[model samples]
Target: MSTKLALLPYAAPARYSRDERLRITRLAGALRLALNIHPGNGLVMVLGHGGEKNNLEALETWVQRSLEAQALPPNRASLQPLLAQLETYLTHWEADK
Candidate 1:
């Protein structure tokens, strides 16, 4: 028997200030570099098989540590969109399982 899965509703693209957009662009570049340099390592391993909850927790912890290391304020508004994207990805991944 075949099973049909319900599709998730579309989400509107997030709006960002110029500074926030720059930050997001830089972050994406960094992630691409890391993945290219160390395929199947570190964060990839954590997010790969750790399940959704653990993946989110690990991502949050990494974000916190990165902010601390950079001496940045604890304001996470700029990252909310990125987090939301990750959450949506995780939800879809779980459904596929």
Candidate 2:
């Protein structure tokens, strides 16, 4: 006789750990490997603002440090599109309240 596993109740989305976030960021980066503001880049900014109020300055600082440490150049020209994407993400963040 065939038996089925017990059904489990639905649960909320699992919270991501630091490593999980990093992994996700890396994967995102890979998908947009050519972009100036890829997932790897956004990951830092996203983490800083996670579950907290929006802090543009803090997000900017985190992005700057992450890029600088990696020896990436300071080029806002390449960053504009990414900035726009971030703004959109931030809008959704605010709406979650």
TM-score of each candidate? 0.31, 0.31
TM-score (C-alpha, index-matched) for candidate 2: 0.31
CA lDDT of each candidate?
0.43, 0.41
Q: Model 1, which residues run further than 4 Å from truth?
A: 1-9, 37-97
Give, for candidate 1, the lowest lDDT window spanning 10 residues.
2-11
lDDT of 2 at 24: 39
Screening candidate 2 with a backbone cut-off below 3 angstroms (N, C-alpha, C), the clashing residue pairs are none
**Residues 1-97, model 1: lDDT tens digits:** 3334432232333454677545644554443343342333444333433332443343433443444444444344535544454455545655666
RMSD of 2: 15.2
For residues 1-97, could you state the per-residue lDDT of candidate 2 as single tens digits? 3333221233343455677445434433432343334333334434353432333333544444444344444443435444444455555554553
